[model samples]
Target: MLKFVKNHMESIEGVATYPMISLLIFFVFFALLFWWVFTASKAYIKEVSELPLENDNNQPKEDLL
Candidate 1:
């Protein structure tokens, strides 16, 4: 299976650049994500973190017959 894939990949033109471009894109995306996480507001993060524990009383009460 490995040999088959390797042989097929070698047949494609410009296949080498594809891996490089994909790697660059992956690196850039994670870098931006890390920057955003570090620079995000503490209050916003606190609110988001507490979202699951806060009850807004939005749920409808179920009627028991």
Candidate 2:
């Protein structure tokens, strides 16, 4: 199975560049995400974090009849 797949891939032109392009895309995505995380405001982060708790308290409880 491996040999067959290898032979098929070897026939395709410019297949080697695919891995490099994928690596570049993956690197760029994580780099941007890291930058955003570091640059995000602490106040905004705290507000977003409290959203779940606030909603939980505001929800009405339904007692079974």
Global lDDT for candidate 2?
0.86
Compose the digit string of candidate 2's lDDT tens values, residues 1-65: 99999999999999999999999999999999999999999999988876765545554344221
**How well does candidate 2 score on lDDT at residue 42?**
100
Model 1 spans > 4 angstroms off = 58-65
- Model 2 scores worst on lDDT over the 10 consecutive residues at 56-65
Put down candidate 1 lDDT per residue, 11-34, tens digits, no spaces: 999999998999999999999999
Question: What overall lDDT goes with each candidate model?
Answer: 0.85, 0.86
* TM-score for predicted model 2 compared with the true structure: 0.81
How far is 65's C-alpha from truth in model 1 (Å)? 23
> In model 2, what lDDT does residue 28 have?
100
Which residue pairs in candidate 2 collide?
Answer: none
- Cα displacement (angstroms), candidate 2, residue 58, comes to 5.3
